[model samples]
Target: NTLDYDYTNEEYDLIYNPLKMQGKKEVEVEVWDYNKVGKNDIIGVVNIDILPSKNKETQIELFIQPKNDKGEVQSNLNTDQKLGKISFSMIYIPEDDYLKRLRDAELKKRKTEQELIRQKELEEQRRLDEIKRIADEQRRLEEEKRRQQEALNAQYIKGYVQFKNISVSNLKKMDFIGKSDPFVLFKAGESSQQTTVAKNVLDYQYLNEEYEVLYDPSVMQGKHEIEVEVYDQDSVTKNDIIGAVSVDILPSLNQERQFDLFLQPQKDKKDDSSKSETSSTNSDKKLGKVSFSMNYISEQDWIKNFKQEQLRKQKIKDEIIKQKELEEQKIKDEIQRRLDEQKRIEEEKRKQKEALDAQYIKGVVQFKNISVSNLKKMDLIGKNDPFVLFKAGELTKQTTTAKNTLNYDYLNESYELLYDPAVMQGKHEIEVEVYDQDSLTKNDLIGAVNVDV
Candidate 1:
């Protein structure tokens, strides 16, 4: 007998009692099956015992095809089916562990990124802080240097010096210590000339300590060559003849006088004869008629010219003195004007101070709860009036009232009374009134006990 089974759609098939059996015992049956299976066919071999506790019941399924044209079973099968049972077991996995690990990794990555970001920010901040610190320090140093420079500049001195004297001759050598240069005036005959005698005399005080020869009146009056010297600070004779001066002196007045008398003629012939005899006796004298007359006229002209020059000099002196007096008077007037202006300013300041003091005194009175209205009624607002005291609780509940109200509109010139519930304890209400600059009452309000103590 032959049994066939098919296992195709998740089902098992059994084939038993094959026609060709091979076994030693009668009860033990061997089945012959193909080694290979075809599509959806099974191939295998098994042995079984029918009786006496069958030799472990065996089953075989074959997957075969017709080997010949007669349709015989083939030994080789070509199928995806087998005769053995296939068993599968499933394992359960928890997502928490993997999720936790992944979360941890993600958290670590985030932490690292955050740390890197924090470090970068810190580095950037440090760099900025360093730059700012350096800049601030540089600025501080520059400011210090500038301040020091300014101090040094302030330390240097800048000023001017002026000196005046009647004449350069009146000035001593040492007087040129702080002077720049000196101007000299020479009055030769009737003509006066001004000249700058020396420049930077203090710089050349060595070799040329003595006055220049050109400045000497004796040399200027005589016909001779005069040399001037310039020296250095070491007193060494640097240039002994830096400048030269030539001068020619005129005839003396005495000689001119003697020649003038010799030119006069006698008034009578008898007198002339006597004079002629005397003149003959004095013939050896160095006076000639022509020379004597010329001398006489030159002497007369010199006298007239001298007097005119003197008068001119006097006029010039008077003019200089007048100008000096006018300049001095102007300086005095300016000083007096400044003094008067100062005094006026001082008086104004004093008045302002007195006014401020009066205001301060008035402000003090407001703190003492003194009746400002009574003072105002007495017209004693700015009179430095004495303080008035009120009975402890005499007017406590008088309940003053106000009309209109106080406002910030007139803050500049308005006066308003303020109430303190702390001081007006147990009182029903407090009222404030506003008054105008003319002391006329403007606003008042009704009192109430709504204020907190």
Candidate 2:
């Protein structure tokens, strides 16, 4: 018998089934809660497999809830408990056995997949390493072939050759065949030989694959030992040699030495032809007498031109000066216009202030006269001097003269003054003088009277 347990949703299901054919099977299952199970919570079973004569202590694993219904597991568990015992003969198997086998196969398949992925990574690394190794070998072979070609072109011999007493017509072709720098040798006679050295060959051409010829006739006709040296473009001497050849002087035969020479025309001869034609034309025009004064007018024309240019410049300068004067005059006129406008405005303001001050002084003078007349008519002054009476009443006073004074006080509604004998009581002459605070005279009245007072 095998015992299997599965857990779901905080609950566990235990299935006990016989493995093979068996008689009576009795299993005492003891489960101990380890991580999250409490007391009497089954977590595993001992003696889960029992046969007829044999008791198998198969510790069957029980799936306990990793978390309880509250989504938390206890840190420790209590002791084991005997869940129950089962006794039965060979019977049916549980359905969870097939499900457990399927779960084990899936776990094995996942492990195999992880191994395959690791092997693929290792194979790709090996392929990259192999590609880098092949590229390094091709660069080494190309450097070896370039060094062998320069060694074969550096070997030759050196000598000089000269020619004498041999006509240049006799030697139509000359070839110096060796690795040496050879020269043409010229022989003068059988016993006496004059040799001219050829420093180097000229007009050398390679006719075939291996032979080269010097084609200049002057070097071939020379009677000296020619010093020849073959060099490369770097001026390194590859070959040097000296050789001599005798030139045989032949007696004069039927040969006339004739040569063609070229001469250029003289300058005066070409000028004389043109002068003769001019003279002939001048004779024909003798009657007309084409007279010309060989006079130089450049300086005079330059002076005139300079004077004209100066006149033009002076005109331009005058124009510029006139424009500047006009600009300045315009600016001055603008300033004067602004000044006139400002003066006009100031004059108008002065007139307006004078008018306003005149009106204000007139109103004040009228108020003083009215106040003095009303005070005298209403018997508002005491019998002592009106100035003294006003002073006693805490009014302010100004003595305009020895006999005339201004007595004024301010009430809540209006300003009042008293002029005692200057303004009479029944028919008084109120000589009231009103002045500004600066004591400058504003107005004066002679007999501002009230009839009743």
Candidate 3:
């Protein structure tokens, strides 16, 4: 095929596919030189071989030879010759092979899509199964946990109720001369906890006691109630119901709360026989109010608290003993001080009596007749002369003898002594001495005499 060049000098593209492919392997081209003359001269003739698998565009070169009318090769060409060579391309493509390849590619795409769809379905199924398994395991674990908690709670007393100040309000007077003999009866369900009587107190505090009960949160948390009733005792008639109160056992675990509940009066004994669970009693005849506090305590915890209380009480007892010892010591010290004070007072009185006795003087002394029994001798045959002298205290008055010679008649003499009353009253002493006149040596002496004045 020959194509015309465009009007402008620009590049051109061409795509060609064969409609019929028999067995053509090569192509031939002939060129003729044309002029205004008759019979165009043969310019050249060219031949090209097709290359296998060259489906894309290709370029080729061919050498052409000039020929005359006799069909002889011309070696020389004038400057006015039209053409000298030819260039073109021949591409051969196998249509059957290309069509087979297209069909194979389409088949491979379909297979890949089917495999992806199958894998998606398998993933969805696995997700659903895992969700169901997780749900079942969670439910089983929750059931097990609930059962364990209940068992632990049942092993101990988890609740307590303390009843105190159970009294009556508008008490029905049972006696004429005195007030009614009132009493309180406390009950946990049907079991009686305590029954105590009082003589004549309107707001009587009958019982202050703590009671233990089982408290199961699953079974009987808020439903458990403690019942309290007041009754007026009598000698001849049956006990009359004063009032009754019921308090709910609160819900808690390891925790406690206190409540002050009022006792509602029940119907007359002729109407009702037992205490009702409801507080729908005679409002006008409200027996009175009951004061009590309830608490929740596990059995083990309750025992531990009891031990702690005992220790506290023992410590207080020891402190009291020490205080008593101190008081006794104080009393003994006070007695000793009083005895010492009394002894000191007695000693002072004795000293005063001694001082008064020293001021009074009353004793007297008188010298009687005195004689010299043994005198100092001056010679063996001659007798010596002797005389007696007397003295008392500081003042001494000797006796005035009225005899010429010293004789036994002259020995009797009296002396008068003077002294301070305080000094003389204690000890009034008088002294008497005898002396003899010697002729040659010192005076011979007779025996001396001493006396108290």
- Candidate maximizing TM-score: 3
* TM-score for all models, in order of appearance: 0.18, 0.16, 0.37
Weakest ten-residue segment in model 1 by summed lDDT: 287-296
Candidate 1 regions exceeding 4 Å error are 1-301, 362-453
Model 2 C-alpha RMSD to native: 53.3
Estimate, for each residue in 286-381, the C-alpha lDDT of model 3 and write its tens digit: 445555545656656767877998998998898899888888988888888888887788788678757865654654445556554444554455
Q: Tell me the TM-score of model 3.
A: 0.37
Compared with the true structure, the alpha-carbon lDDT of candidate 1 equals 0.36
lDDT of 1 by residue, 1-453 (tens): 235454355533233333544443222112344445654333332222334323232443333233334433333443533443222221222346446866998999999999999999999999999999999999999999989866744432221111112122212232324533443322222333333345545322112221111222232332111111111122333322111111111222122221211222223435312222123343322211211111111334445755888989988989888988988898899889889988999999889856654433211112222233322232234321222222222233221222222322222222233333334343433333223232365222212223211
Q: Which of 1 and 3 is ahead in TM-score?
A: 3
Candidate 3 stretches greater than 4 Å from native: 1-160, 172-179, 189-196, 200-223, 251-262, 265-285, 293-296, 363-453
Q: Point out the worst 10-residue segment of candidate 2 by lDDT.
A: 287-296
- Clashing residue pairs in candidate 3, if any? 169-287, 169-288
lDDT, candidate 3, equals 0.58
lDDT of each: 0.36, 0.34, 0.58
Sort the predicted structures by lDDT, highest score first: 3, 1, 2
TM-score of 2: 0.16
Query: How close to the true structure is residue 421 of candidate 1, measured as C-alpha lDDT?
Result: 30
Candidate 2 residue-wise lDDT, 318-338, digit = tens:
999999999999999999999
